[model samples]
Target: MSTVPIASSRSQWLPAYLALVVATSVATGVASWMFLPRPELGPLLLLCLMGILSFQIREPDVGLRISFSFLSIILLASAAIVGAFGAWLVGSVSMLIDRRQRRWTATMFNAAMSGFVGAAGAMVYAMLGGVEGSGTVGLSTVALARDLGWPLFAADVVACLLNAALLSGVIHFDQGIPFGVQVRRVLSGSGVAFVGYGIIGLLFVILWYPAGLGAFSALLVLAPLLAARWAFIQYGEELRSHERTIDTLVTALGTKEPAAVDRSRRAAVLAEWIAEELGLTPGQIGTVRYAATLHEIGHLGVATRLLRRSPASLSPTERRVIDGHCVVGARMIEGIDFLEDARSGIRHQHERFDGTGRPDGRAGQDIPIAARIVAVTTAIDDVIREPGAAPVVSIAEVARRLRGDPGRFDPDVVAAAVIALDKHGWPAGSPAPVAS
Candidate 1:
């Protein structure tokens, strides 16, 4: 979950939500101090230091607001070695010393959430018959596994669920995103990483006690963890570079018509929604976005005067030149490796479903799915932007127009577009009311 504080200016429930989390954490810490056994100072200090370092060295997560780190491994191990109060201390202190400058609300929320996760995990570990600290010293590997394995694993699951729940709560209150959606996103995005953290946390415990490495076990684990962070940084950079390339192309397209940029972005969003409704793969959805954004790029190849003129004023020869922009846009990006699949969509976006329209005249299912999606989405955007047309009225009209024109659009794609629009509504400024 994201450590960044969502702006609370418009959200009435966010401040109240943050206060509840902070208060719950304080109560947990107080109870742990009152009831749990005191932890060994030396090992507790070592874990606290390691936890602070883990937070500082977080890895970037592409397409997500949350940062990733091996702090979970440290927290889980601390639950076993330091007892509940010590675990809470380690988590709280680590956040208090965080070097990143942030709003006080964010700092408080993160620290409290971390402490709560630690204390809860430690409590679960103790309840599940887990041995802590010197209790497992010199135990055989098999014996240690029998005593500590399931407890530590269970502790890890509790930590994962609690952390996701708390984070999802703040997001739901602050951004109005549904609670269930954020929870599912957390599981799908980082579920595997959490499982690996549990295993590594177990290994850290074994190294500290049975193998007699103690605090030095942290040093041995640091190497691979840092390497993984480096790899993710490179991946995030590559994704950013791809976005930069797409932006350059879109900016060039905007030079012909200033409104083209906004239209392209709106079309891309609608196309993505339609793609999701149709259950397309992630890669195919990405291709549809690219195709929608660059669908009008061929106009750059036409003369400025011809482009400025209305379609009704253009003679037969001029109209053909205007219509050929699709081919021109396709050729412009043919050498771009990442856009190879999108090229086909851009090349055929103007084609009619019945084979009566376009440079290639491909009909029905013969047309690429990405092209069909772009056709319907762009048409909707065009209709919505017409002078004096109400957004709600335009949406209904566009849905009817697409459904009624079987020869112009794929019937299946039109149906998906209509459903997606009704479910999610249109983008900001277009204010489409959801169908009841």
Candidate 2:
């Protein structure tokens, strides 16, 4: 549904990939036009206009660079109404009118991908005996369902899968996200909505042909589509607000403990990688990210002098007060509804695997998983940023250091961190050789 632009620096294979997609799309469009019967000009043009309009109305997604739009429904309806060539035409032409400024490569890639997805869906529809262009007028509901329903559903499923694959392919190259991870993210986030879109497309087809409503069918469906878009826009806004709140808290913490600003963000990145490596659910992954980012927020309540002092110089009483920051941080966000699950993580992040850690001495798996992951990630970040440490620590050295601590950290979480760091390497400013 979207095409992310690759950075110019990492674009070695991008031009070749875009060229291949565009070429494949053109070949499919030409071959379908040459072999298939032409669809009616009126319906074809109307559907193309609908497709263009749908593409223009897009909502930003929080988890992806891609935007969500009703273009899929239009593409599905085009496949059911107009055979392969017309569907391809609708899709390719829809990308020509964009409101946002974008690179030529992005436009070309999106147009080509849309065209391919449409043509492929239409081909699947035809292969399953779907008749195009006003052929459903005389059939009873049962007969219509038999001939049109299954084929359209199959085509819809194929279109969704093909679209996800194409989008994932581009994202993998552009953003360095593993293709399998991107695919799973897409499926988990939008699979149900796609099924709903298929049903909407089917209704549009039924209204256009069987009920003789023609283009008015589009108008009839416009309200619900816009309502859905509006709802998602609101959800996106709420997520942005949550981000702003986190920023405010982080900024406040930075005022008291400047080292925390960058450390929290770095810990967040590492924690998310480790959570993914451990195959945690997406919701749990999000909680881990939040916990890691705010793990040191307790520093806000500690004295500035205490935080600035070297660890070896701190008195036991002062250290105990410093340790209570975890508890203090948990209470600070207790009123935040969305952060409720993260409270336990912040509260328990200082807990050790061997039951000797600060405040409450909860050990092993008795500690929240988010806390355990955050503990390892924050330690990794601390070591990477440690004063007098090597300019660039190797992954093996980092792993060795983690293992050197023994029962201080959760062994499983430590292993997951090592594997994740080895596979992905550390982020910028914390360079480490990928482990062999």
Candidate 3:
């Protein structure tokens, strides 16, 4: 749970508006290419310019955004003569803004900031884009596009996507936990720039000066993007405001409810090794890590004492009720749009590959891939988390424990489990790593 504020630094709105400018340029470029005749290179050049601006927009605090705004105006005004230099100049301007100190993982920040400069550069490129590809408007777009090839294009697209992603990531990371943001807002807002450009190009069919119309259209897109930014801000704030309520709800469910589950610092440290052993991609690694923290969320519905009870002490009804948690947890998450992607893991995490598992009794291929991964991980975590285990146990002994009956778990899952145990120094009878 988070408590995003309603009035959090209204200044963030400035950056959001700048971001919109670049977004509109992208929207118009694509539109013009699709609807306009033969598609003169003007709008495309602007798109490229926006690409750089989108990356380079972040500058040294308050002073720079205003400064860049003016520079962008001059760059656009002088576009006919300066051409690509003007475009690159705007990108360089953003890059030049000093942030006082470099962050440990500043690469994405740098790339995204560069895009901001590119956004302004798009405006500069607007005049040149209108010069008509063959003559005065310029060949910078063609030359840059050819020179950079797919690598640059890929970078551009990634920059756009990452700019949105990184912004949300920064907010979440700074807030000190995992929480959801409205992904649709970021995507739609970023998309508007290109859309506005397209509409303007459409009007140019009868208007003649398509490039000029395209610039004005970019302004049109800016309006909506700004509103969207406000919405994003509001959404973030509302999330913050509701943090306490969500936390209380989690407490109502269980001592450590899955919905509000927070990873122990130690668990986070150990998770990295697990991720490496599994050869998980960055994205996959995040999923597994989050799954580990929320693995017990379904237990919210289970009787508290039942969780504490030994296997022998439980009544048949109590035990059955405990096993039904996966369904309960999954259903609870299904109601949330953001968590839908992880519902499969939350539900079938306790299931085995063979048809012997509880709840849905999904077998083998019927099981979701993430659920299978979680099942192995859940068992491994349990093993290490137990106290008074032997330290020098053989990997084969551990393998045998999990492999007691292949039908009880997926063969492949068991195999992966064995490797994970071995990777984490879990020799025969050794104690598993306990959650912090």
Candidate 4:
């Protein structure tokens, strides 16, 4: 996430924000007039086709959610019609139509954003020496390739960057995250696909004008597109399946170790709150929750009787099993791609701030932040849920116990936990200190 903080209000960002709005409006208006009156039926149909092909993909583990509409429509408009104006109308109209059911603010924002992006692309194309309305640049393969390649590519790059910048700026303002983080997240999830689609769109328009394939070529690609959509759907389904499977395993473990179950749930809740207090992004919070929920999963591999016994009463061999649960639980989910971050958190949850942890002797800030937060939250839960203990404890006592062992947990995490616990009203009592 961005290390930079957001201003308390939107007016603080107004100067540059106003510039963007004005430039976008003027550019779009000019482009629209250049394209004139309205789009032909063929282009309108293409816009609808693009919308129908759009799909939403969400990966909860990594916290990435994206709605992807193949880049074909925008790219085609940029290459074929009245330069960028064609793209603007296609994107804005399609978005307005599709999002009509959404809140007015959301629908208008989307429509305006689309128009701005399209206008930016068209302006870039014209500036790059691409003539307006010369969709068909028919020449020999080499000549046409040499002529249109650079301008088209540049236009695509400009559009991509503009889209990223505008979106990232808005997100940064809203979420108080760094622009770089938002940009990196967007690129990692969708950049490559967008670029590839742009290339295909350029090729499609080339064929439309010269080969006379026209709009019918879209029909030829329909089967392949549908097939690709099916593959994406299958991939998304498997992602959901992975999440469900992990939940089931964790629930089963809880059933076997009923005491640990409540503690785990509490740990998960506190960990998420602490993460938020520490300015972790939503994706990071999700990963922390998973790690906290399954940190004790290694206990599943140990004997049930052994788990029920107090840690101090365990034999050396039994202690080893207990110590090794982190590794065991991490191994179980290591192979799943999305849980890569969570695996590290689980493996290191037992590590001490002073190099006194198991599986590894890592120390200080070297520990994963998620793991550190989990350790503090888990400790709090353990203290409150001690057998025969009341559901309540002084928030001060909880803080003292957590801070009392600086060698065991990260101080920063402990501090965040204190604030988070107080904010969330933990220990099942008032925020004021009470006798333990």
Candidate 5:
């Protein structure tokens, strides 16, 4: 098939995400004000939720970018906590310990130092502003526990959740997860989990509460919280698995299609096609999808001069760098567990049917099957992305290019590639496949 030129890329954003965060924060705060306490703190709760945006700050931690994601849950969950403890000060401390001090003890000492200082500061500010009542938590804090019959502890719990969200928002993190993905997975799974757990808790309340499971009623109520964590972890893994695959697909175009320059877009489309032709089971497909995207990430190490210039004009050093892309890519994904599946494929993509490939030079069946499949698709993608050169051609034509012998590709993998492209209505002619 003919290659499609890469489109001008659009910058991704978080508008919908911002709307969601604001909506949730306001909703939680409003509920707290209406049903519980602290109507004055609702607006403050909204401001604290805004802190979710802080994770986007670009900073390199060692070589890995900080994710800043796990704690977003901590923040959203903590909104009530901060609101209840509104007048209390917050703190932070970092210190180096002497030789005899245990590491954990030193860490706790620092945390305590920071926590106490922060608490003192908050109290001092409140005192200066003349917050007179010992029982009052904030300006509009509900005196419901006193005025009505609600337990103070329950009111404090709601306040604690709010406080956690606010503090989580403000606390700067060096690294974590993408807030968007985190939100998606958290929302997707937690929505389902909350409902499920709610039903279970309802049954427990209906059946057990009357039967005097009173000693454990509070513990039974904690089910939904536990469900939230379980749901988050499970769904987060699913989200991350796909994320790794998309990264893999991008890696492929970046490396093998270096000369084509339209690689990112082209490889993405081909990856979609290959995913179908390979007849991957849904779970396996997810892994394959991510692996294909990152199959050429090592190519990033190749010098721009060498990538663009004629091979004849390349210097020895540049050639070495160009050849070393696979190794680089493998190293890049070494830390990501789901991505480990794609590493062998990326590393071996350049390997030939005969054993002339660089790095390890494993030949034929010795090479991982995934690597072979990636190699064939990569070749086809490059041809399609070729600028001004039949960028509108058909899949049959591209398949022919791939089929020509001379140790070009593993023959079975080539067949698999051709079938995949054709069945998916692939190439520059068909609608391009989308990457995550």
Candidate 6:
């Protein structure tokens, strides 16, 4: 099994990404010259402005980011209804004028890639038996829908794939992250938005055929367009708010037990490595990371006196008070809809494999897999961080303890952790494994 370091880091792959951008730009430019339509200054300028106003929407929780621009919808529709050349002109101009990309190289690349995407989509539409120009005027709604819908959908798919391929390639090279993971994140994050925009583009095609890009015709779409943009804005705000709340909680816990918080973060990194090694889905890995970070959140509710006292001298009641933090943390986050999966792990991180530990005593595979992973990772992190309590325990020592401790942790999880630890070049000596 291979392990990935969970720390966020980047490598220098700018030259490579820039080269790709240049290649794509030049290739698309040549293709555009061969097939793209002559410039239509009026609609082209409007589309460019719309593209400029469009922003990139990002949701880190789902590891997704996408550019949300009405210009794209309008341009795609114009491509299907008017011709590919108009879309090429508008998309190319918009990319060049995009002020957000400060670097000339990036700006040029964006323009080139977008122009290519638009051109490719137009070609696809034309190849799919789509009517050109005013020919779309006489078709019945059903005929238009059938003729236009599939081609538009296919074009949309091409646009998405091209965009994703270009961006994901850069990310993969620069960050050394998996390409599939980056692609999945990008698509999942914007899947609904992209589909909605595509549908809107189709609507634009239908209206433009009959109405001729007049004020009244454009006005017809304003309500729905505005509604869609507003919905996206609201959704972005909600995600940001949710993220802020998580940060606040983590900060609060850090204030209460700085070491514990640090330990939690380290555990999260290790757990991510183990989860990936175990072939968990990206979504599941995200949940594991969150759970690991908040695994010790229950410690925040423990009394200062209890924290200060040595564990060896703690009374039974004191131990119980300490042990109940999992339940407390779980309860605290149970109401949070986004943290639902995390809450389960937080609650069961203390549970043992042999029906002997925690609030619920489930044995072996009955325990939540996430909780089991967290337990193993947290235990290992605790040992690694412990100071002067014991001589630096070796990875072998850690594995030995896990193997020796009968049902304290899941063996499979423990095995994964050991492999990850070894693969990450975990220090030779660390503290003995701490009790969960």
- The number of the candidate with the highest TM-score is 2
Candidate 6 per-residue C-alpha lDDT over 1-436 given as tens digits, one digit per residue, 9 for 90 to 100: 0001122324466566667666766676566667665545665555555544442321213233344455557557756654676666566776666444556665666666677667777778888877655667778778787678788888887777766666666656555445676666556556556655788777776776654663344567756666766766676677678668777888898887776656766777788777756767667877888888888888888997898788888999999999899999998887788889888888988899989988888778888878999999877766666556455677887788778887798888898888877656452333434342
User: Candidate 3: where are CA atoms >4 Å away?
Assistant: 1-83, 95-293, 315-317, 390-405, 411-436
Name the weakest run of 10 consecutive residues (lDDT summed) in model 6.
1-10
Q: Rank the models by lDDT, top first.
A: 2, 1, 6, 4, 3, 5
| Predicted candidate 1 versus true structure: per-residue lDDT over 1-436, tens digit per residue | 2244556633677888889989999999999999789899999999999888887877645433666667788888998889899889888877777676457787788889999989999999999989998787877778787678889998999888888788778876775545665666565556456656688788888888878898898888777667656755775677678789999999998887777788888888888778767767557777898999899888889898998887779999999998898899999998889899999999999999999989799999999999999999888876776565653464577788777777999999999888877755785556464343
Give the residue spans of candidate 1 off by over 4 A.
1-5, 8-16, 96-101, 123-128, 161-169, 176-189, 197-199, 269-291, 298-306, 315-376, 388-436
Q: What's the TM-score of each model vs. the native?
A: 0.76, 0.90, 0.50, 0.70, 0.43, 0.79
Q: What tens-digit string does per-residue lDDT give for candidate 3 at 1-436?
A: 0011111222334345335544543444344335433322565445445434432332222110111112222223222223333333344443334343253223223323443433333333443343422232223546533422222233233333544454444433332212133223333433233222322222221122323354454455444434433444554454444444344444555464332343222232234335444455444554554444455667777767787777678889988888788788777656654456567876887677876787778889798656776676556555554455646335576567778767766666567556655544542333443331
**Candidate number that wins on TM-score, 2 or 6:** 2
Q: Which stretches of candidate 2 lie over 4 Å from their true place?
A: 2-5, 8-20, 354-360, 422-425, 428-436
Candidate 5 weakest ten by summed lDDT: 1-10
In candidate 4, list every pair of residues with a backbone clash.
Answer: 2-178, 84-122
Better of 1 and 3 by TM-score: 1
lDDT of 4 by residue, 134-221 (tens): 4455566765564555566766776666666765676555543356667765555555555555666566556556667767766765
Instruction: List model 5 lDDT by residue over 10-111, tens digit each.
Output: 112222322343444344334434543342354334323322222222111210111211222222222222332321111111112222235443233322
Tell me the tens digit of each residue's lDDT in model 2 across 1-436. 4444445524466567778888999999999999987778988999899888877877756355566677778888888788899899999989867777377777788888899989999999999998786788888888788778989999989988887888777766665556676776666556556656788888889989898998899899887778766766776677778778889999999988887888888888888888877777667877888898899998988889999999889999998998899999999999998889999999999889998986688888899999999889978887776777755577777788989989889898999998878756785556554333
Cα error of candidate 5 at position 216, Å: 15
TM-score of 6: 0.79
Model 1 global lDDT (CA atoms, 0 to 1):
0.80
